[model samples]
Structure formats: C-alpha cells, structure tokens
Target chain A: MAKNEIKYLTAIKADKRVKKFCRFKKYKIRYIDYKDVEFLKKFLNEQGKLLPRRLSGNSLKFQRKVSDAVKKARQMSLLPYVTDLLK
Target chain B: MQLLQDLKLLIIILLKMELSAITGFLLAITNNQKSFKNDPLSLGLNSYLCRPKSVFADSFRTMRNVHWDKPPSQMLWRINRILNLPAIAFAKAGLKQKGKMNNYELMVIFTPVLSDDEFKAEQKKYAKLITDAGGSIVAENPWGLKSLAYPIQKKTTGLYWVLQYTAASDFNEKLKIQLLRDEAALRHLCTKLDKYAVEYNARKKSGAKTGTEKLAEV
Candidate 1:
C-alpha cells in the first residue's frame, strides 16, 4: 500500500505543470508603469480587480509592482476602480 | 522508541500551531479588515456591510438603469483631495527650491461652453503666460471637446489642452494661482517631468502618435 501511495504521489508531482516564466520578464519591461493602461489591463480581471499571482502567473516581485501601478492608475483616473453597469 | 515517537509528535504539533498563528497574522495584515474596522473615517466598509438588503437591491437596480443625462450629484471633492494627498505632500517638500528650470506637463480642461474665438484667446493667454514666465513651450496639443469620465462642474464635456514646457520651479505656484482664479478653467493637473519623461514626450511628438491621435483613430 505504501509503495502504491509513493508511486501515486510521484505521478501527481510529475504531471503538475510548473509556471517558471513571467510575462514582464519575457517582454523585457524594466518597470511596471501606471501610464501603460493597456498592458496593465492584462493583469486585471473583468471586475477590474488585480488577479492573484497564481492565476496571473506573475513572479512575486512583478506582481507587487503591477498592483502598485494599478493603484496609482486608479488614483489618477487612468483606470476605473469598478466597471459601471452602463459600460 | 516510544519516547522518541512522542517527542516527534509534540514537535509536529508545535510546528502546526506556529504555522497556524503565522497564517492568521498574515491573513489579518493582507485583508486589512482589522484596520478598516479600527479607522473612524472609513464609511465604506461599515456602511456597505450594515445597509439593508432592500436598500442595496434598490441601488443596484437604479445603477443599472442610470444614464449620463444627469450628472452625479456627489462631487467627491474630499475623495479627490485624499487621492491627491501624496502628490501634494511631495510638492510641499520639493517647492522650497526657487530658480531651477524644470520640464513640466500641464493639462487643463476648459469649460465646454466657450465659443471658438474665446477658446483660441484662452489658449493664447496661457501660451503668453508661459512665455512671460521665461519658459518655452516645447509642444502644445489641443484635444478639443472630449467627454469626461465623470462630469465636473455639471459639464459633460471639456476642451482638453496639453502643454509641455520648461519653466522655473517657482513658476508653477503662479500658474496654479492663475488657474484657480480663472472661472473658465474647470480642471487642471500639472506634473513635473523627469529627464526620461521629457525624452519620451519629444520622441512621441516627433513621430509616434499622441494619445489623442490614437483615440481619434479608434
């Protein structure tokens, strides 16, 4: 039974897909800027909320930068906090 | 062997307790719920949560049907002030220096009611103001009659003008006072540009499409 459990665990681990690449790194973006609203929108959901790193597949540092940029964009009125019903 | 097993179990239990404690602490900090509750000024959270379901439903229904015919009554000036607090603080700290020439980008939204002649005159007046202050206008783009995201001073649309210039550090104070005194100017934002920003704007103006041009194309 233990042998079967170990085999199953190894199989699960082997089948799990790892996200080792970051979008910002791939694009060679040095800083996540608020002015780039189009680029920033990719990191947001339909509700205008910042997606979690797990879902967005962003590195920890890049995610922090993106969130900060999004907040600044919101403050500047470059982006909306919520999508109004009237669109 | 039993004693060793017991020791291992105890260590595991302690580790589990510590992990849980750390997770709770992290959750508290990340959610910011405790801070929101503690803050006296935050009407958003408590009001949103404690409001009656009927009231919530009514607002949601109204929100869906609402049109832009009537401007939103709440000006939210306090919210605007709060949002601009960091910029204001930075300006206060940086404004002590007097004769340093710096690049600045200014966007002024004029009341849309102005006639074409008055608009031209107003533009000339500001252009003269920059020259009189010993500053040179690098680029000027007049983005005429664009709909605002939200109405300002009950005006649905505004005549947007963007000016990039190099001026003395002290010139911004005078410019701000003038803008504030002008009733025709609905809204204005002045941002000091760094070396990189100046280069980017120059490049953009020379060949690349300006933001308004891109919008126009769309």
Candidate 2:
C-alpha cells in the first residue's frame, strides 16, 4: 500500500507539470530574438522585472536564452530597465 | 502558472477600479484581506496592499491565496488570453495579432553635432532612398539629441531618428550595407515589427495612455 501511495503522489506531480510545458519547445523556436521586445515582455513582470524561470515554465537552456535576450533588449532601449507603470 | 498570473492581474484591475469605485463586485482575495474588508470604496488600504506579511514585506502577495466568491474560471481565462482580449492577458498574451504587414522599424543615432538643416537633409536622403526602393514610409519621428546609456565613439549623446516602412524580405541586407557605409550615424538597428509591436505602435500613435507605460529610451 505504501508503494502504491508513492506511485499515486508521483502521478499527481507529473500531472501538475503537464500543464507547465516549455513554450519554446512547443513552438520549436530555435532563436529567442531580443529585437522582439513585445515577445520578451512575456518573461517580464509589469514592473519590468524578469520573471523567474520556474514561474514562466521555461526550460534551462531557453531560460538562459531569454535572460540574454532581455538584457540585450534593455540595452537597445527596445525594452525598459525599469517601468514606472504604477506611478 | 497562468491561473496565478491571471489572479494577480484580476487583483490589479480591482485595485485600479477602486479609483472610480461605485458598486462592489465579487473580488478575489489574497491572504491579507484586511484592507478591503470594510468599505474598500473609501480605500482603507495600507500595508496589505503594498506590503503584505510573510513571503514578502513590501508588496502585494500577487498570486498567493487569491480566493473569491466568483472567480474567473480557468477555461474562460485561457480562452480570453487566446482571444487576446483587452485588460489583463497583456493585450492577447501568447496569441499573435492578426493581419500584420511586413514592416520594419529602424532607429539610427546620428552624431549630435549636425545642424538642424543637415539633419533634415540627411533624413530626407534616407526617406528618398526608401521611396526609391519600392518601400513607403509609414511614420517618422525625430527624437532630437538624446544622451546615450553609454558612450559610443567617446560621444555621450546622439541625434535619434526613427522610421517605420514596409520592404522586401531581402532588402534588409542592402539597407545594412548602406548604414555601414554611412559614418554620420553612430549606431543603427532595424527590426521587423511583429503584430504586437504593430498594434502597440498604432495605439501609441493614437495618443493613448498605454504609451506612457514604456520609459523614454536613453
């Protein structure tokens, strides 16, 4: 019974992750271009902060790609360093 | 994860609605539901709104423990996002905007020492070049002299000019060569405008409030 319960718990964990699939993999996107500021905003919060990899469900490789792109976009002024939307 | 994001968005919308608050609707609640307990219309908001306890101390909990009597259903939220509905979902979320032209947005930083006449003449030269190349200029905005975030060629500031035009797919290479040959421009970038960027540019041109959300590019 103990073994069965552990198996059941793992099932639930898998079920939880099923919904959080990595979008880059789904879209088959080979490159995450920083020029697409509009797309990069998905990885940022309203306050212009980068969302965590876990929350966004980004794979490790793609998450690094996103961070690099976001930083580049920020430098290019295509995206903002800080957004004062609240003010 | 999307549910959490949506709940946070709902709370934010509710927070904003408080400004012209008339009637109270069923609002989703975060754990620290103290502020809105009473007549939230009067805005008894304090710590809980900006700085909730636990996990965080200086901001709203965002998506944590947001419970409401009549919460937006998960399926409905997903559908709403897919449809790219306004207010929350960040203007259509993941879905691509429909009917976008193949347009490119170009930004060039010219040496700041150029006189106004020189700048206009140079701008006209590019405009004519674009027209001659079977492309049409959609919009032009001269940002004037602006300081850069860092020094380029030891200069602290440069004249910024922006242009949006639709061109052939392979035309970018030709344009790049032209820009590379032009010594007057300190820096330049040409990006194909996606549907969202197109929508954003149109909205901004309409003089809407959303334009202020992005900061002035330094």
Candidate 3:
C-alpha cells in the first residue's frame, strides 16, 4: 500500500508545471517607469487591478516597483483606476 | 599774590565740576525708559530695577508654573528660521540663475467640441506662450479625438496635443497656471525630463520619422 502511494506522489510531482521566467529581467529593463503605459499594461488585469507576482511571474522586487509605477500612472490619469463594464 | 591767583583758579574749576554734575543728573532723570530697553545690558538691569519686590516673587511663581512642553514664541521663531535656510538658499539660487533652459514635455487634452480651425488657433496660442517665455517648441504631436478611459466633465472623447519644449525651470509654473485658467483645455500635465529621457525621446522621434519615410516609399 505504501509503494502504491509513493508511485502516485511521484506521478503528481512529475505532472507539475515548470516555473515561468520574469519578463522584466529577460528584457533587461532597469527601471519600471510610470510613463511606459504600454509596457505596464501587461501586468494589469481587465479591471485595472495589478496581477499577483505568482500569476504574472514577476520577481518580488519588480512586482513592488510595478505596483508603485501603476499607482503613479493612475494618479496622473495616464491609466484608469478601474474599468467599468457598462462604459 | 601767586598763591591768591592759584586759589582763584581752583575755585573756578570746582564751580565748573559742580555745574556739570548737576546737569548730568538732570539729563539722567529726563531720559525715557524706552531708550534703556533698546540696549540689551541696560534692558536686563532696567527689568530688575523697575519691578517691585512683590512682582519678583510673582515672577518666581510664574516660572515654577511654566509649561516646558511649549517653548517661548521667540525660540520657536528662531528654530523655524534656522530650518528654512536650505529652502531660502534654493530660492536665491533659482533667482540668480535665469534663462537656463531645461527640456520639458507637456501633454494637454482639449475638449472635443472645437472645430479644426479653432483647435489649430488654440495650439498656436500655446506655442506663442512658450515663445514669449523665451522657450522654443521642439516637437508638437496632435493625437486627435481619443476616447478617455473615464469620462471627464461628462465628455467621453478629448483632443490630445503633446508638446516637447525647452524652457527655463521657472517658466513651468507660469505655463501650468495658464493652462489651468484656459477654458478650452480639459486637462494638462507637464513633466521635466532628465538628460536620459530627453535623449531617448530624440532618438524615438528620429526613428519614427525614418519609419514613416520608409512606409511612404513602400
């Protein structure tokens, strides 16, 4: 019974997906500036909320920077705070 | 006879000294208390001399009852003046160095209801403002009638005009105030560009021009 369980656990481990690479690091982006709206849009959802680091595959530091940049952009009306479905 | 003459001179000197001493005493009595207050040393002595014995005891009681948490107004003013030195120096430096132009990017959104001629005229008016302030326009891009993500003043569309210019740092404040006062402008943002951003913008504009030329050829 223990051998069967071990075989099942190993199969689950093998089936797990590979970790994704950070896009900013891959592109060698030194700074995540607020003015780069096109580049920043990749990290935002349809509702204008920032995607989690886990889902976006961004490094923890870069994710923080991106969130800060997004806030600044929103303050200047460069990006929307929230998207309305009816609009 | 010479002894008699010496006695006479001594009497004259004594009379002169007595007369001077009486005049000095009269002058001291007539002097205003305000004159003593102007001199720090005299003011300290005057406070001690002028106050009655009971007042001195009352002052000691007041000193014991003083709230140490809130300092005297004079001390607070002194500290505030010291803290403001850096800001004062910055203002002085800004005044001394005039006409040192810096690169700036201004993005203005006009209300979408204007005709083409009016829009062109409004653009010329802003360009004139820049020139009047000793600034030169580098590039102007009119991104006509774009839809806003959120409605501004109940308007869904706005006419966007982006301007790149070089002007003195001080001119930005004046330009911003003018934009705010203008009824035609829906919204405006002016950003000071560092050397890196300025160079990047120049390169990007050149690349865009060449790309357009190539497209036209094709």
- lDDT tens readout by residue for model 1, B1-218: 33443344345445656433333333223323434323434422222211233222232223212421222222122222434333342233222212458998887889999999998898899889999989999999887887765567887788978889999888989999999999999878787887756766766678874332322221
Number of the predicted model whose DockQ against the real structure is largest? 3
- Compared with the true structure, what per-residue lDDT tens digits does model 3 show for residues B80-146? 3444323333232222223368989888889999899999998999999999989999999887887
* Chain A (alone) TM-scores for all candidate structures: 0.70, 0.74, 0.74
What lDDT tens digits, residue by residue, belong to model 2 across residues B61-102?
233234322232432243334444443332223223222237
**Per-candidate DockQ versus the true complex?**
0.02, 0.01, 0.14
- Between candidates 1 and 2, the DockQ winner: 1
- Number of the candidate with higher TM-score, 1 or 3: 3
Residue B182 of model 2: what lDDT? 89
The DockQ score of candidate 1 comes to 0.02
**Alpha carbon deviation, residue B106, candidate 2 (Å):** 0.2
Extract clashing residue pairs from model 1: none
Off by over 4 Å in 1: A1-81, A85-87, B1-98, B208-218
Candidate 3 Cα misplacement greater than 4 A, ranges: A1-6, A10-12, A15-22, A30-37, A52-78, A84-87, B1-99, B208-218
**Candidate numbers, best DockQ first, in rank order:** 3, 1, 2
By TM-score, who's the top model here? 3
